[model samples]
Target chain A: MSSTASSTSTQIQLASRPVGWPTPENFRTVTVELPDLAEGEVRVANEFISVDPYMRGRMNDVKSYIPPFALDETMTGGAVGRVIASRAEDLPVGTAVLHQLGWRDIAQAEASAFRQVTEIHGAPLSLHLGILGMTGLTAYVGLTRIAGLRSGETVFISGAAGAVGSAAGQIARLLGAERVIGSAGSAEKVELLTSKYGFDAALNYKDAPVREQLPELALDGVDVFFDNVGGDHLEAALDVMNTGGRLALCGAIASYNAEEPTPGPDNLSALITRSLRMEGFTLGGHFDLADEYAQRMTEWFAAGEIAYDETVVGGIDHAVDAFLGMMQGQNTGKMVVRTA
Target chain B: MSSTASSTSTQIQLASRPVGWPTPENFRTVTVELPDLAEGEVRVANEFISVDPYMRGRMNDVKSYIPPFALDETMTGGAVGRVIASRAEDLPVGTAVLHQLGWRDIAQAEASAFRQVTEIHGAPLSLHLGILGMTGLTAYVGLTRIAGLRSGETVFISGAAGAVGSAAGQIARLLGAERVIGSAGSAEKVELLTSKYGFDAALNYKDAPVREQLPELALDGVDVFFDNVGGDHLEAALDVMNTGGRLALCGAIASYNAEEPTPGPDNLSALITRSLRMEGFTLGGHFDLADEYAQRMTEWFAAGEIAYDETVVGGIDHAVDAFLGMMQGQNTGKMVVRTA
Candidate 1:
């Protein structure tokens, strides 16, 4: 139904694996000639591309739930766009889709690799990359399924102003948590946690040790700890967790780029003494809950019971920058590169 | 009900709280006058007394699941014996009973605190302290209910020569595990794991780092990790765990007496990438499964599908020595002091 005559594409490639923290030199931008579409292939001009903390772990040449980002190849992640060219009958031109062909403005892949998204009447298309996408689903699955969050329970979240953490704070409140406490890196983020994200109490970890501050913030003790930043935050949460508490470990952003093995929480023995349960999970294994999350998330958004933030960095040229910024805690919520 | 003419009883009392490792001087043995049985009380002459790892935690003056032992008070633990003098109508003088008033020759407690144990036609009374008791039930609950052990799954256990660990090796086999590997502190204990307990492979953790030995022992990677010794053994299990692996943390005897905080596993980040689960539980939280565990364990014993051992230290005077020795890994299966 629609077509665009584009013969060239610009993409970011992982030139070499970084030693510790990745630098701009570790990535390279390249221009490549586009080829004609084959049968069952669709060409998409991406509207929004996600840059998440998990990508930092994939930058290393180590095996994980998802494979490492190969050298000299365009990095892949969640992206949403309109199908500008289609050789398949089922996914015709002008179809809105979501696919894993990010780090570039234009993507040509088999139609089956992309899934068509039904537009939310008034929501932005980029919401699929943040609140209604992997980030929001990760926060939901970790709280309801992994931690089994109950009403009248206290919850503590690390990286509380970031994408998944921000959503986790709100979701825990809606799920009937009696008190929600959060930890962030700066005073501004701490204020936003209570004023914007509805956290009962928020602390700036950089101001003091989390172990000493957590007990004071969580007056009654935390029943669920949704961990995003691991190292010290995890250790602190373990110290103040209530008996039979649950920890939903979504990310260890604190140690993702460390050069050497980081020491784990010293208070892990608390798990035994308190009979706690700590479960680590990735979003891919829990796709079965996506529809349920979307339905509930959509309803909450409609009723103004949910809110999300995005730090949009303009252009595909800045995709690597956006990723690096997200890893460095430069974003308040989801960091997405607007490539169109 | 016949009553003994003896008016004196001897017992061990905690003299001073230990800082790092406990010593003989920390306990004292003294004689106390025995009082006549009250309306609802009974006098039990213990046949066997248990000295377990969990007792080390209770010795410290800190809050835990169980209250700490008070200064100058007699220590308490599991014991099996015959009721000597009973004033309660529910319990007869000659009834076999299991109670929590050990570390002494004679224990006088309310009849409700002691439960009657129907004598197994041919089993020794000591089996109530090892395989058919708390130790055996711990292994069953951790493997079956907590770890959710499945058939054809490789299982690894740390401190696999101790009471709970020894029973865990056999229980994993009976539960249809594909491979069962274990680690102990010495060669003799390691040998017992394979020869007597039917472990597929056993390692002496003292000879080499568990992290180096686990990969070779568990070539296919481990699905369930029954943690009895925490520190290094837990770290090693985290390294080679299969995706979606389950770790049932039963005890952390390795760091039970540490004066300073111990560093936990450095590779805990493996939890996130592998989508692993680590849950800590105590036997008290799982008493509901006692009957089920006893029935299955008894059946296994009858079929000759299970084997167990006990390191008995004779006489009540040696009760403190037995407990100290057990804490140092001196005993094999169950460490019991026979007072009769």
Candidate 2:
């Protein structure tokens, strides 16, 4: 490993802005010698790095909630690692912590910037980047708060097999939803949705048009739609939603990498006729609900009431591959890079 | 005249469902003998009849909040008329009443069906249909309740020269919107938007692309959008919306006549990135707020804080012309047909 013998860190930097769908050429790998830890600073050796769909939006230099990733700089994201060298007493060596200094094998940061996460209770440390982290919290808050999910309401979510969708399906069920339905891209993912994630019905969008297949799955019109995949999925949801339906616009991974502006749903007028409401949200603006989310998700995880899956790509060298693969629907769940 | 010595009422009936933009052939003129009033019924000599954009949706055979007009039957809508004859003791001749029995020179309905309007205090009786009635109520509820309009926020409205839009523009100004911008189809209507309706800036959408013209109009991005015209107008609003912008999806007159499904705004992903919200509403569901809307609008009108306009086409013979003309954007404000 690069960390052996020499005090050096390896990191991936944004080489250039991608014109469309990103490839390996957009990133460059480099090794830099580490400096001695300064007062109040600690050096961390990362264990797992999260790769998410939202990161694709950050690569573009457009104004968004989060600033675009700077060119020639290491990209930042959710990561959990152990402190190897420390000048701060609070973050001592061998302590596991979470920080936003990902895209590198070794992260050096102010101790205050790293949040100590001692134990996730029987789950791997990676849960700090997956189900027990932002991924799980987003699903919980989106359904309960954003969509105003109520007991006995039917909930439909797109991108069911993805990290957020998988968690959302189980969360909806636990929240007393009468029925939970989901859609994924592959037959295996569809099977996994019902067998593992507890989705009452799952659709393989590749087999038929979502609008055609969704109606049968939603015997009565859907009351709430958790929209992770936009485009045709949104159109289908609009078609099948009941009057006064609520849609939580979580993610639009379907058009995240489109080279040009894509066509919107043809049936948005249904929003007016049905008096539906669609509200969009991102995680950063909703950290206030994190504690509640963590408590519930932890209990659910411990009791086996909720299940999570991770698509692990071994090594920091393949982080870009994992990100691209996740974007392409190649990963079944949370796609992460295990740097250690 | 049909209401004179003849004792016959002339009404317009839906002849056939139009394929796209409605034509005169879709309706037929008929004069029928008046039937004797029942125990609780009153005969009204209609004065002013309303022709609204939403009436276009009722012309279709599809189910909606309001049912489709039965084939070969006189279509129903909002109108203000005077009670000419009554079997009920509460309603006397010459009492100005408001009811939903439009599309004719005269009407016969139960006494409970008509709401009596004694006086609008210097405002014309027709104000009950335009500024003091459903049109004005729709604008008030949409901005204050739906969009949650706050002081010092910029407001953008599409179809700003029409009934609800015209009222909405003035209401936004009264609500302490820092700036009010509106879009219209013609230069005349655009001028009236600023000169009469108090819009800070107005765009004649026909002169140039709204997307290109809107950015300069909404300098800091709009906080609230009262969407009366959908399609490209909605797309333009999405392009220039600030974070947490609220969109009140009031109408989609732009697509009301669309022969086929029209593509929605391509930049809907902005809803997620900007944390914007779009909610759809109809007037019927919000009648509980009618008294509040009436009191506020009446006070605003009495104080000259609001202005209203009417585009009148005389005679029941020209009601179809008025309806078609209003749909074609020929009217600048509330399009009403006068039978008296």
State which candidate has the highest DockQ. Answer: 1
Computed on alpha carbons, the lDDT of every model, listed in order, comes to 0.91, 0.91
Cα lDDT of model 2 by residue, A1-340, tens digit: 1133226889999999988899999999999988767788888899999999999999999999899999999989999988888889988888999999979999987899899995856788988887788898899889988899999999999999999999899999999999999999999999999999989999999999999999999999899999999998999999989999999999999998899999899999998998999999998788999888888877888888978889999999999999999999999878999998
What TM-score does candidate 2 get on C-alpha atoms?
Answer: 0.98
In candidate 1 the C-alpha lDDT for residue B215 amounts to 95
Regions of candidate 2 where Cα sits further than 4 Å from its true position: A1-6, B1-6
lDDT of 1 by residue, A188-262 (tens): 999999999999999999999999899998878899999999999999999989999999999999898889998
* Candidate 1 lDDT for residue A112: 93
TM-score attained by model 1: 0.98
TM-score of each: 0.98, 0.98
- Model 1 alpha-carbon miss at residue B114, Å: 1.8
lDDT of 2 by residue, B1-340 (tens): 1234225789999999988999999999999988877788888888999998888999898978888888899978888988888787888877899998878888987899898995866777777889888999999989988899999999999999999999999999998999999999999999999998899999999999999999998889999999999999999999999999999999999899999999999999999999999999998789999988877877787788887789989998899999999998999899999988
